[model samples]
Target: MAKGIHQEIIGRPHNLLEHYQPIDGVVDEMVDASGNPRPVWKDFIEALEGLGPEKLAQRFARADQYLRDAGVYYR
Candidate 1:
């Protein structure tokens, strides 16, 4: 999904501005306009990359199980 987001951002033309609007004076927190990950996100992206898909899925499942056990929900 992260890779998909990156691809979507990079696939757009530079002149296209209708897809997203930035908050006044605030930079995009995740990817740049060019779809490149920001420096601040480097370590996090690296960690996810290191975990690979299977481990990441396992971790996500564990987190979901924990949330279920704790009765966490959104209305």
Candidate 2:
């Protein structure tokens, strides 16, 4: 299985990374605002990174589509 650049960005499958990046980046940025690492966001990211690529991708696609349908836009 080849790892992709997007995967490395979130330390998970590329698809999963796409689904979670917004949430992750938001949590990370918010935590950073407090000048400390937020355990909730950190643990979630770690847990996501441990899933199998296929499984992670499935989740990613689902979340991605849902967000899109809901008009959740990102840069």
Candidate 3:
């Protein structure tokens, strides 16, 4: 994450960071060492979190269907 870059969460329905627990030795690309969200990921994650569980599940299902329709498969 770049220093001096910041993003504000507008109309946030929830504090998305409430559930994040950074692992001691793992590197996080979307969050800083102090547990603040990186500028680029802040809005994106908040939007996703704002979708709520049911809508999120539907979106995931749609994504999976798209992948399967496109012949994206794994062994």
Model with the higher TM-score, candidate 2 or 3: 3
Q: Which 10-residue span in candidate 2 carries the lowest summed lDDT?
A: 1-10
TM-score of each: 0.59, 0.39, 0.59
Off by over 4 Å in 2: 1-43
lDDT of 1 by residue, 1-75 (tens): 223233343433433333546555677886676756679987787786566555665666666667668988644
Tens-place lDDT per residue, model 2, 23-42, is 44354552554444466666
Clash number by candidate, in order: 0, 0, 0
**Which pairs of residues clash in candidate 1, taking residues 3 or more apart in a chain or in different chains?**
none
In angstroms, the error of model 3 at 16 is: 5.9
lDDT of 3 by residue, 20-72 (tens): 79998999998999999999998898898878655665666666677778998
How does candidate 2 score on lDDT? 0.54
- Full-model lDDT for every candidate: 0.58, 0.54, 0.68
